[model samples]
Target chain A: MFKKKHPLQSKSEILLRNIVVTAMIVFFLVFLIIPIGIAFVGSFHEWNPLSGTYRFLGMENYKEVFTSSLFGRSMINTLIFSVVVIIFRVGLGLGIAYAIYSPFIKYKSFFRAIYYMPIVTPMVAVAFVWKFMYNPQIGTINHLLGLNINWLMNPKTALLAVMIMTIWKDFGYAVVMYCAGLYSLPSDALEAAKVDGANGRQVFLHIILPLLKPMTLFVVITSIISYVQAYVQILIMTEGGPGTSTYLASYIIYDEAFVKYNFGYASALSFVLFVITAVFTWCSFRVSGSEE
Target chain B: MKKKIMLIAMVSALSITSLAGCSSESNKKEQTKIDVPTEVFGDTIKYDPNVEVNNGEKVTIELWEWGSDELFESLIAGYTAIHPNVTIKLVNNPWEDYWTKLPLALDGENGPALFNIHNSYHENLINYLAPLDIPIEDLQADFTGVDAHIIDGKVYYIDYGMMTGTVYYNKDMWEAAGLTEADIPKTWDEMREVAKKLTIKNGDQIVQAGLNFNGDFHQNYLLGLNYQLGENIFKEDGTTPNVNSDTMKQIMQMLVDFYEVDGVGSKDFGEKGADSFGQGQSAMVIQWGHFYNTLNTTWSDINFGVFEIPTFDGNPYAYNRYNGESTFGINKNAPKDQQAVAQDFVKYYLANDNVQVAFNLAMSTFPAKKSLANNEEILKNPSLRVLAEHIDRYIWPGPMPETVENSLKRAGEEVFYNGVDIDTAFDEAQATIEKDMKNSSFVSVENLYKYAK
Candidate 1:
């Protein structure tokens, strides 16, 4: 440090490092970036996989995507699903994480494991299990509540039912993230607030909450991304059914691409969703306004 | 260092030698050229059970079917026993997953040699299917619903069986309701009354549904009802949505009334409508031939009977909308030898009496071959016999888009589950189906009519 000296590496060693880094960059570009780029390009072309044909359609596919009623409905449903999922995931996650990370709590690891079990379980299996539980007749929920409401069948409840399953399956990640954030929180600031005639709530709101901003951003962005991309749970639980009550944007894209073989339009729809997600991510970063 | 290099060489040499041994073992098992015979089965299919194949070739033909694997396993084993060179593999994907995976699977080089698809998706798959080796005239001579497999004047698929929708009622429930076979419903109005009578309720809850009217097969029933009323839901060109009509509205109204007005069924039944019927919690279900197998296996003690779905009040006949079952086709892109072997297996599979009887018994779907219908094993079951008798009566609903049926099903779901008005549901369904049809890749409705003919 006194001499401002630079350590030198062997030519081969530097070459090896360069090679590894280049390989990683190449891999990312090939596997991730290229496919996404192809999808963007193909959004303007009609892709007929069977005939092995792709005819350029200019902005027609994009226009169709914008005009499609199903696309609009799916977007609305996805927004609702994502917002509801975020509320549950963030609210419950923070509360549980705060409680578990508190000094008064015991068996912290056991509680964390219990909450994290759903996250580890396969979504399909979780979806099916929840679907059975939501069954109107012999379902656990109906039997316990002593009401014969068709949870998955009723349009009013189908999306909410699927959202509950999604939240249950995903909230554990938030809980764990929040717990880590709480553990690493600046205790000195919290103590200062407490000592300055602040109560627990004030200590939490004024000191802990502000300090946890980075973790909240992380959880919120990731949760929003995951929820926006949800398809399998809806596919399994309600099949995006009861007259498309639970149809999400991702589900509609899948239906278009796979079910209807409308790949070009589906690609356009995907790009739209991609743009929405990118915008949300950007907005999130801007609003958070804090970074290490 | 010398010792380490020597050890590496020894290991490499051993690995190569082991690999060579395995390869040689695979190649040197046995080989023989066997001639295929020109013997014909039933004057329709050119199939001989003992027809020689390339002996010891070890060709594994994968068949993707949606039904139970019991009969398929037995048939494949039998085929393997007869022609030891061929190994028939049954890849049984459930119905929904099968349809979703098939189109993608066919895009690859390693797709199944043969696969079954629903008649609904036949249009979507025609380009990918290999035409059956048999002559179209010969196939039509033997197989019922052969027209359903035709595309561009070539038969590319064949049915192992066919199922026409019919009213399957619990005889015990009917008797409990103080009714008999002679008193069976003959008109839509009569059917509703019978359904109401057969249903049993206990304090605002249904103990037994009269007619388990739910979303399952709702479109098929509605289509048949529409037919009875002399209305085709789709235009002559199959993709043009013609569901916005008076006759269609009447049909939807009847369906809606079954849940709301008549209370013969409920949303509580959901997808388990058939299950309720099987368990005797429902008196009746308008189901295809497969209900015979489900009920026989699940509720063997419950007495049951089958009747044609009742006609509209003024219609002279019941409209039986049937779907092809066990519908199979060979992959067009398969290797020539594999495709030939697959064709041989298909012929062997279809021609074999044991396979036919066993498949029918397991699936409760009627044999596609008319010759198999009169088999004592089939005729003994009155329900199956009734279903089989009307095999010729199975109506082909031109090449209708699956979305049309799905949209109709959703309309029923809206009425049944969401308590939406019948007219409102129909209007929504008509709009959705029209948009779907417009955006659809399917040919015009006129082509469907020509194809159906």
Candidate 2:
């Protein structure tokens, strides 16, 4: 008993849909884009949060950031942190995923849940637990190893200690993604390769690795972005101490903005960090595309 | 379609009823008031019985403290009962977060009515605090260390309590290391020898540190040492940092010796100094009187004793840096009525010796007033008794306390971690301090209190 809509009325309905879509776009531009733009502009100014005062100085904040030794050290530390975390997270994640997915393995669902537990655990709780484990005096890690190395205090080991906790906390995402990727791959292609006398490793290396590119790209990109901006663990565990050995860019920015009240300088530092993350993301996609 | 509409109507009715239920629940909020013995309670606090309650008018006062809420819980309840119209909201964040959020809150004109700040941070917050509503003379007359927090001759802060820094030693560890009370070091040189003696090593690993040299408290700890040696790291004007001075060089060298040469404590050990001492891994640690209660409660098995930080020359001077304790300031931006009420609460809080006694007992810190120094509660605690005798020597680090503290830390780290020579470390620290000092929006005044100097 419903009347058929006229073609003119359908066009009007599409126009109404376009208006709603435009409104949503405008909302996003206001809420998201404006704040980011403000931060960008504020980076070129000196802002005192306490006094509610600001003064614009073009390129000065950037210059100071570049010249500051703390900034330079933190940049290098950030790079090391990101690179090491990405490598370990992806490599271990893929290996574990493959092992669990293999026919030889048992208790697959249980193992999957176990691997995903760390991801569900709060980072703050994880950091605190890991801090206790890394404690030089009574930490479980040292107690078990029968060694007296200061895991979180020694400059040589502090960053590595933090990275280890981070990888353990985050790799479950990679596992889940890889597991899904493995499930979606054309099963006959893998079967065909196996029947052609391709051994297990050969089957993995030749067929699976190439086919899991999209999942790898997703995991790598997300992990890189996450690790590059990573600092909460550092803040809780070490607080960027022992002569700034574990100081990362994000931590320095946080300390400057919050602790030191150098909002302008912090903004500039954050913007630089943003650019670095963007370039790394682009490079990741480029490398993936080149491989394809 | 009618069935679907009927189902939607039922769901909507249910949602409305649930929301109404929530509103009713919220409206039924109960304020639990404790029944106190009028005879004892009325004697402790003086309240005007005739003051009319501002009935039907709500006045909410927000309070922020970097401490336990329990200390204020009873007081808030008591105050609220008296002034039923006034609602006191208390937010207690840890020290670090308090400082970070405070500035932003004040800038936004939404700061607490009454908040506590340390003397170290008072300079940075000078402009943001409301002047005391009461007469400045009255406040000074009642509170000790009132001068420490005064800026530009205005009384903006009052210490709710005070405690002085001192070195805490593990008695059991000393005895285990074949030492006794007679071997307590009186000078830095003697302390080094004692530390070396007390240190227990299993191969290359230090199982028991002789003296814990933590980086976190390097500034507060070294300030005492600097004071003992008559060193002012900041000039009289509080503008330039005396970073590369002879005294600083000596101090840096001493720290380096502790880490690299004497091997008394490792950089790692310092990070976990409190824990190390707690677990009997460190023989000696430096902390304030608060640690007395901390040690007793947490590590009661370990026998610990307190002593003044050993001086360079073994002088009789028992000086150490003390901070403004329980120091509360009124938010300059708080509403007039709230600020007035907050000040009234401050006065009421300070006048009640029983409240002070309870706070000190709970926190194990000394009360702010001199009269409470000999209170029975303090006399009962052995550590508090010993600390009481030395409270006179508790000094304020000259000006720009945090800056000086941070510079000392950086200098120590440079010597200890980076292997920078003492002179170079001090030099670099001096340069950084000077640069930072210049960059600050407001400069600290000339040396305010000569407590140690």
Candidate 3:
């Protein structure tokens, strides 16, 4: 049933396709596959690149990572940060997208631009601005609120402060994604719901939400992965301070690899984080009923 | 079909060639001759000032430092003027990023030929450093802190300066609080009293802290207090940390009381002590001598005065512990020609008296060069003069591991932020340090404080 091509034309097209496919394979192998392979192998050894030392100690690095209290604390902190950020970022993002997509709403593009600004801004710059704003003495947050709370210095509030800043910086991304999803939504279902005298809340709850599930799933899974790997804000704002209150699993990986020069242990920790993220992603997909 | 096969073969060849290029670069490094002098322990290689490095070949030596780009620029220009065949490129990273990047950079082929070393991370970096060929007797006679950096007969780098904690107070705030030159406190009790008088509060909030020690407990306060108590934070072996000792608990409690009891400072008063003092929100702060330069550049308008760190009692073993501001270490992994030029630059840096004076003044540190101890530029700085007066009262704690500082800082945070008991906090800090030290190559310099008496 397919159309046949001339021999010479087919040969040229196949040659171009082969070259493109080969180039992509080479790029991935060099950049991604090889690094992952090295990390996997290095995870079993005691490696210090600076000192040129490497010793094989099967699973010892993993054992230490599991036994360390700081590692456990970091895991819990990262989980809490990810869960909280996902909920707020996705929820606020959907609400803002829906509000902007409403027929009565004016200046929809302007609102979209305003909300999408933070996503494009550098995380380091955003983190520094938030660090200053959370300062108790001279920060705008405390000054405007007339409160004396130490947002980032107190152990109880440090992680929460970081999570809030993360949400603010990232919710914009979800907003932009959801806005695109909203634009592509079929108008027939919405018109029918209105024609049937359905209220705004009912339409949103029953029809809009279920239709937007795929977008929501994409946002949630990506958010989970991104939030689990969140460390730049922690590095800049707190350095996991106030007695490790803001220590995330990724931050621990950074500290082990860079600060402590324990590359092997860091590799082990990275693999553990990778497995956790995969599990989290699997669960997200399964719960969303999109596994098939 | 033949075209497809040919494409696959070409792609495989490209990948193999790219990897081969990487392997060949490493092979080149392996084949390169190490031109450094080989001397046995207790032997020294005489340094020649007129030695022709790189045989007058035009070479560029990359020098990496945390900060002080302008100072290095001037020094580099001076060196290049004297030796027209050599060029020096300065790569400056922020202080926090430098430690993390330096090791990774040194591990690779394209690392800098010369890089500044900090004693805190010296042990981790020792294997990558090329030992200096300077004579031991000349180093001992000319530099005060050369003994600490010399291992066997090899000198990685001499300490260019000595820095310790000092009490920096705003002169305007001091006078406003009716304080005079005689009001400068010599003991902790008197200092606390002065701090109380200088503190200004609005209800429960401290608008102006008399003395702030919030985030600087580890760097500026704890070590000094430990010294004043005649205690070392590390055991004699240095590998085993003793941060949970009775003396440490005493000092930790005193630190807590400074905030919780005296109310002269607040845990959340400002982000850091130095920043608070610089912003005119604090009357006094205990900072190292380098803070003098920081304030001079960052907050030049503040009229500040320097005094010796107050002691617990009138006389103690020493008032504080000091660490060295080390000279640059030559990268052994650098190209042979670059290493030769780096070595020559080190010689030029040490022999030039003007460069020595400029470096010490710029760092706001006491000169490691004995001749520069009385140099006009060195003595002109008020903070350096204060540091010089009590320099003997400070003991050189040999190359402290970063773990010690980090653990102590965490301990302070636990006590201040989490309300953890001082004993538990310190015990945790000790455990952390001990565990970290097991993986470290750090060893204490014996009898570092033997002359404190």
Candidate 4:
């Protein structure tokens, strides 16, 4: 029956498909893989800008990177940021996606667009807008809460302040993604769960959550990757300030290369940063694979 | 063992790639032959001892300077039109972005044929520069002041501008605090007392501040203050940092007092505050004459004036004012034999009275030459004279070594923003700067002794 069902495509059509596939593969490898590779290499050498000399300094740059103790601090910061961000993105995204699927909301597409507006907006502009919002003296945040706390200045509160901006800038994308995922899934399973001894929480946890794992994994991995590279928010808001309290690994690498002019050290820092991220990625994929 | 080997190989590969990128970039810069300014026009111009000329077969001289383009262009245009054989091309980069981009830009295809760099940056690019061989007699004959341009008894760039590090304040704000420039105070104690009265805190909001103790400017001034205390931050020889001094501690305590003030705009003096200068957030700031432009542009409606920074108590009537001069030099690589022509252009630019008036109006900068100091049009402008008078008292000893310069800049930023005490800041700045200077891989720090804390 399977053999009978298979009617072969024309040879020209098959050739066309092969060519397109090959082109896509080459494009991805060249554009994506090569750049990352170059960055990896740029992270290791002591580049003398004048007289144009570059000397191989070896693991010394890497040794300095680990010795700095900043990587450890940043790893913790990044983890905290990712975990918190994931919960908000996933939970809020699911809720909004599910609610919007209903007919109760008026001008559904308009509300969806408004919700997705921040998602499509430039991060720099968003960060700036939020920067004014989180202003210590008369920002929207301060005015709304009547808290005079220096959001970007007070070391204790700087991260929290940044987190709020991150959330506002991000949640819209998650909501959009979740909307697509919810639309394509089988609604009968969710209804069946409700019919079979399931309440609201159980409906979500036992049936719908299982099917959402693939989407959840996609969102979680991408968010984690993004959080690791978070620079603009820090750059626009704090510039890794109040004595480097807000410094992420990415920010630290930028400072070493640009501010300090220690390009070799910066390259070394980047190499390690890539390695750490790769390991994190592998661990997440492994978890996803096992659950499946 | 397999995982370890894999890691080792990957690391090795990464290093190779990084080295490859750096080496290739440098080699490309070296291999490519490009036009440099001095090589184009060192000898062709009809050199005028008294006035500059633009002679030499229409040579294009490139100048990469950081300033108001209108000022530099008008100045160049004044000289170029007379000789009719030369044209000046101007490239302007902001101070913050210029340093990072310059070395790379020089490596790239569109790098300046002629570029101006700070003395600190000059060391890194010495190999890339054309060795200027104009005689001192010729240089002096063309200009009134060779001393300002002299680096190690050799001229590097033709000096321009009036620059003096001073405390500039809004006059209206000062009056609101019941003070005058006469009442601007001489000692730190006087400054604080005046600032207390000047501090207009309408609840937590500072309607007007008595001072904006900018840490970066403070650190630069602290070098002068260290001189006042009779010890340099870099000690007698500059081979070592001499930051842990009684006077240094005193300076740190003074800053802490400023930050410790309740509700005077900020606990930290931020870039935001500096940008908000005209908004009545700050009454006074220790800044350079370049700030004249910022004040005029940002706070055009506000009444403001300048004064010398007050004295440190330890130094009895000491003045350690510093100024950076923007200079024009004949590039070592401008076509061929263009030095004479370049000097002629420089001389013409300097001598033209109308050019001087236009520059004064456009930039509000002090003319570099002593001759231009009292030009009728220049003298007529009160703001120009005020700037000129201040820079007249400023002492310029060419440029510091790049290593000392960078370390000083970083330490200044960290100290000011992080609330680090001045002593520790100076100590760290000294230590890092001394190491760089001693290596002589950078500029020599041996001379820093004379300017030490």
Which candidate comes out best when scored by TM-score? 3
Clashes of each: 4, 0, 0, 37
lDDT of candidate 4 over A132-190, digit per residue (tens): 88766557887898777667766677777888788887888888887788778797887
Candidate 3: give its CA RMSD in angstroms.
Answer: 11.6
Question: Compared with the true structure, what per-residue lDDT tens digits does model 3 show for residues B1-453?
Answer: 323322322332232213333454543342232122222111122334355668877998899998755567656755665566888888999998888788889988999999998888886789889998677788888888677777888899988888888899999999999999999999999999999989999998898999998888988877668888887766776667778899988988888898889999989898898999999999999998878877876788899999988888888778888888888899999999999899888877786555666677777779888776776657877888887766767777788777788889989999999889999998899888887777777776535554643
**What iRMS does model 4 reach?**
4.3
lDDT of 1 by residue, A106-153 (tens): 999999999999999999999999998998777899899888888888
Clashing pairs in 1: B236-B445, B237-B445, B237-B446, B238-B445
lDDT of 3 at A263: 87
Model 4: DockQ vs. true structure:
0.17
Off by over 4 Å in 3: A1-9, B1-57, B94-97, B108-110, B450-453
Against the unseen true structure, what C-alpha lDDT does each candidate score? 0.74, 0.72, 0.83, 0.61
| Candidate 4 wrong stretches, greater than 4 Å | A1-44, A195-197, A290-292, B1-67, B83-102, B108-110, B116-120, B137-155, B202-207, B214-224, B236-246, B259-273, B313-323, B328-365, B375-440, B444-453
Judged by DockQ cut-offs, the docking class of candidate 3 is: medium
lDDT of 1 by residue, B1-453 (tens): 323322322332232213333443332221111122233444466566555776557777788888655445545555675687887777888876887678778878988888876767765677678887878888888777676566788877777676667788988889988998788888888999999998888877888899886657465577667666655556775556777678777777777678778888776764577777776678888877766766665677778888877877644333655565644678998888789887777777666555565566555667778788787866775656776644554555655677777787877777766777778888888888776665455543323332233
Candidate closer to the true structure by DockQ (higher is better), 1 or 4: 1
Model 4, B1-453: lDDT tens per residue?
A: 323322322332232223333444543343232111221212221234333343245666567777555445444543554445666677888887777666666566555556665655655565555434556666565443455455666766654554555666778877766776578677867877777776777765665667775435444455556555554444454345555567666665566567565334355433454544665567777765556666666667767777656666624323454544544545554445355555555544444434434544444556655555676655554455654544433444345554444455445545655566666666766666554344244322324333332
Interface RMSD, prediction 3: 1.5
Best by DockQ: 3
Model 2 C-alpha lDDT versus the unseen true structure: 0.72
